[model samples]
Target: MHAKLTTGAMLLAMSTLLLPAAAAPDWQMVAKTFGKSGTETPDGVYRIGLPRTDLKVSLDGVALKPGFALGGWIAFEPMGNQAMVMGDIVLTQDEVNPVMKKLEESGIEITALHNHLLRAEPMTLYMHVFGQGDPVTLATALHAGLALSKTPMENAAKPQASAQQIELDTAAVDQAIGHKGKANGGVYQFSIPRAETITDSGMQVPASMGSAIAINFQRTGAGKAAITGDFVLIASEVNPDEQPRLFFMHFWANDDAVKLGRGLKAALDKMDLKNS
Candidate 1:
């Protein structure tokens, strides 16, 4: 009788351990873990911006603002019992390995690491991260990884009146790019998604998950601006012939860069499917 009672009690405890959490994750506690509040989109994605305001970076003789270029962010989307998290971490040359090591130790996947700019003073590297697990646990792990670097954990201050607005000729930029852009924290941003589906590791990838072209323009001075963004290319459009077209983009585009790029993409999409 005593043995049976002990066995039943053990089974109950094990079942309790295997069960999922009784309630949803404490988002406020997650924010407390990272020392930053976040906003939730209508689709239930909670995103926290971790701009590298501590870094003083400049490009093409124009100073870069956190909202303009150093805007690091981490987002969490609830996925059943767990959560899927994705983010871009902006780190200096020296802080990359240490922070990456910490993130790896915490079970975060470092998807890609590269630069988003050229000829910028005090170069910075971007570390793209993805993970799926308990929400609070994931946030804690991310906080630990960031703590390995000199990333600031203090509450961000309110933006100044001038810094809150963009000073660029936005209409001219739209006409030249052929894509309308929206203002985001003083930075004008545009996103051009691929017409076809994009897959990674045999799974369909969405545009929100770094599968689209993103362009950002930040006003450096009156009538002057600095631009930076990513070009998401399909597999067939990645040959040597297409390399120079993207790498050496600044030299061209005196006229309509977007139309030229769109035409090129369309051509490539219709390329000889037999050979390509």
Candidate 2:
């Protein structure tokens, strides 16, 4: 009986030794590979934003700021020993094919390629990409894809100073929104992630992966600015109607705080009704 017990104990020890050890993801390498800094969300996802500051886009004679309409972002989440990545890249008409080719050649899947707006000048397109592999490898692939376009790489050009002085109460706006925002190329931008989990393709998709509500305010004049951006949502959260709508809105303000509040509340009401 003693001999049998010894053999069983030895077998158990060997099995434990044979089991694969869990490895923590190297987030620094991912950021370095992408040529940008990143942050880890509350849901334990690492994300980086890449705004298209190179493009000068417009809609209906109004110039569209980068934060307003030309932002791209990538998110990384640990999955077992590897990592999963998802991103949406904004591309101009001429840069689409080249960037798509790069992404495809690097083993990244193009999940979607579509327009986010109509009647926009210089036509813009959004390309959604996905990959599952080493986080650093995925970032490298994304960098290569972005390089094919005019998308600025690290230190390509310093952000130009705004010619028009900002007159809006930015601090008040941030406090009212309940989140701090950053000023990028004259646009005050906020990225607020949902407090719930989002999933796609049987995998948990983090809020940083195009699942957050993006808000941008561009200073247009004294005590005035133009607000625009989109609320990212999954298919199930979208309204199933004849037009298949996703929540989106825009506002042009000129020193009218009450009017702005009312407009935003009305837009939210409409969105809630559609989703309901």
Candidate 3:
């Protein structure tokens, strides 16, 4: 009995020593247009920038506007024993492709490259990025990508897009989702409830996070059915609800799935998916 007890104690001590500590990734250098007015949260890293109106928007002074939007992202998991970085870029529409191509060449991955608004002059593109290894290394990669962008590191010089009521056929969206939805930018938005039995990371997912399905539509054809945007979902075995609001915005129906999967997976692991 004494021998067995001694062996068990030794095993317990060995197990305790093998446990890993909570990770704290070091962000070494960030070379962004605004020089880092962005905020880094437990959830992710976010940068805010105001593009030059003269180039991105066609407008004059008195109408000048300071673009103040947040680009939130973070690193979640470790890879092959290294830290993985993941995040998104929420900037004016035109900045998307440039950022995507640059990041790709620099060994960064872009999962979903799309928009969040409608009729915003110059448009806006939301790019989701993912990577692995050192935090600073990933940040540096982003810096290089942003460096190639035409976006003005400063604020907007004029009011390019107005916040008017966008027209949308709410009835149609509701019909598709089998529920009622509200109007957001002249377009109808619908939310579908996920099956209650589903949960992510052993946590109960709220109706707002991953539970409430969001559907945005645009009128592409004559006056009939409009082409709906990609239906964002938790594709990986990791339920998106595990990180609540920390899921990559994939360009699902738009191709580029294989190219996007690798980086997006890395980003998801790095992000602290808490809030829905």
Candidate 4:
């Protein structure tokens, strides 16, 4: 009896050790599972987990930037089984080139460089960076790069907007993507299929199992075109250096050049997908 009790205690302790401290966040698998040639989803179909990044910054605390914009960048499919990144970047200022040079010197790839905003800030710039391995480490490197900027904290604010208001445009946007988009309070999003010819992470998604690009748009007014707002996309497999550049360029600098990115991302986060 004593031996059995001791064994049971050890097993109990082992089980306790194995348990995760908290429930892991359900990170939706946004990537497509493409199969071989001859079978693929339609072209221009977007996918999820294309490995992307978003950085939102503010100046003067006046909320100059938008939240959750994709920064118009994406990670390329891995090469020969290795990670490859591809995407675009829009810079805020002309001086941003020096920052890009610094990043490249630290082993990052600049896929593209440009501007999404017309005019703003101490002249912000966006750099599309690509690389592989250790997401957190990449984040660390990104944090390092951001130190070069004068933007303020990327603070997290409480969500605004309600679910009922979000449902207003669900049907309309859904029609564009060929499916019903989810309505979560203030946020409405739709993820559509990607062409089967597109493959990522050694996974072959059938035409039926294509990729998904989620768009979160907000409704600013009650009129027909009232839903005018920004759109957010999730690109999987994005590296760290690229993440910072994209975050600031695509999301943080939304003064007209960013379109509806700010309001769209904000509204989407307030939504409840299950309710939609």
Candidate 5:
């Protein structure tokens, strides 16, 4: 069975279940204009996966899976005559500036530029963008910017397109982590949502649109796993000065599955400390 892709994309196309009885935008047209298809999440947000399969990155000794850390994605939430888009653009060191320039030229706001992992063969940077406008226009501009890089425009390799075997004990991972996980192209992913509502520019943004705590696990060896994801943090919990309101973290371990689960639990506890 193919993994239900909510935390991933290259294939953000159609809504799996029928949308609500209320009238909705022509998502099929939007998906076509974007040059890729996608799926709609439970929260009514539409997501497109753009995993950077072009990059062969390894953390420590384990090769990183595209869904683990290289998952590039764009999400759309409809708003009457317009829509809001948010996404992460994966770029190598050289592709950063040109892509940023292109995105800016098209009026998309570059919300962030940072690294998710520590040290890898070739370093990677992430660009976060936000915009609200016509769905087709936004897709056109976003596609133009992605054209500058090697990010695949085709959906043949999207996480949801195929059913890759997952050997890890994902059931144990779900129990230890306190939430069920979804498998996408052999990667086990968890999108942990918070208790409070999150809004951007006066509109509510759901956890599916990059607001939730994301934890991804991919098997590297026998009882050994490689994990990486972003922890959405609030500034008030800490000093709240100089620190951005949110924090994204990456963790890697090649030792044992038990130890990996323990460490991940500890990290989640700490990150969710204030909320709990």
Candidate 6:
């Protein structure tokens, strides 16, 4: 009976040891290191939005709002004892190289650097950064890189008082889109996940990594608004004709998914003929 009791206690201790460790993200340290507050998603990702309010951008003679073009963001997701960070930083032509150098020096990888818009008054570029390490260290590196640019560290810019009210029926828009949205700096923003799962490098990609379809609306007038943002789609879902052309499709002044789907299909068909 003593041997049996010893065996049972040993089994219980082993089972406890084999159990999964609790996920604990040091959010306070992350915020302190980044010098900005962040919002935690339901899935436990802490996301910080750093909009370039100092930039006054114009496209085709229309003044572009920060929500429309100058939004930079970083997200941290807990990965076991460490954390994984992914971010897109907006920079001017001159600021790009300096910021890139800072991030590289800090051991962050530059995944992609490209233009999000075709032609604007002052050209803008986006740098995509990825890093995995101690969460506070990652945030510190990110903060240092951002300091190289004119990007605001915190709520440095005062909110503009608008005489015009928001014209779009936001509640209806949310219902139609199947997701709730938040208003930020005069833009109604929605971050919606794909119905299907998304994976990268054989691992599941979370919505916090800018993998969700981001839609933004800036009110122009009564019942009128300018819409802009991108839709995240995988290769198979984006193009059925040509060799899987996976990319985010950015749209301006349009929010119809069916029309965009048709446009993508047509473009793919044309590419297929060219390849053939």
Which structure among the candidates has the greatest TM-score?
Answer: 5
Of 2 and 5, the candidate ranking higher by TM-score: 5
Pairs in steric clash, model 1? none
**Model 1 CA lDDT for position 48:** 85
Residue 213 displacement in candidate 1 (angstroms): 2.4
lDDT of 5 by residue, 4-57 (tens): 667535344544344455456678888888889989988888899898988999
Q: Residue by residue across 92-132, what tens digits does model 3's lDDT show?
A: 55666677788899898876666554554555566777676
RMSD from true fold, candidate 2: 12.5
Whichever of 3 and 6 has more TM-score, that candidate is 6
Taking the candidates one at a time, how many backbone clashes does each contain? Answer: 0, 0, 23, 42, 10, 0
Local accuracy of candidate 4 as per-residue lDDT tens digits, 93-182 = 543656577657666666556543433344345565665543333333433443454333232233555523553656666786577866
Model 1: lowest-lDDT 10 consecutive positions: 243-252
Q: How far is candidate 1 from the true structure (C-alpha RMSD, Å)?
A: 12.3
Q: Give TM per candidate.
A: 0.71, 0.68, 0.41, 0.41, 0.75, 0.74
Model 6: clashing residue pairs?
Answer: none
Per-model lDDT: 0.80, 0.80, 0.51, 0.42, 0.85, 0.82
Order of all candidates by lDDT, from best down to worst? 5, 6, 1, 2, 3, 4
Candidate 5 wrong stretches, greater than 4 Å? 1-23, 157-163, 239-276
TM-score ranking from best candidate downward: 5, 6, 1, 2, 4, 3
Please estimate how well model 1 matches the true structure, expressed as its whole-model Cα lDDT: 0.80
Error in Å for residue 9 of model 3: 11
Query: How does candidate 3 fare on TM-score?
Result: 0.41
Q: 187-249, model 1: which lDDT tens digit per residue?
A: 999978889987555444556656679899988676977778888876576775664345433
4 against 6, candidate with superior lDDT: 6
For model 3 the local lDDT of residue 273 reads: 72
lDDT of 6 by residue, 82-201 (tens): 788888888999999899999999999999887788887698888999998889999999989888888887744455556223557999888988889877677888888887776655
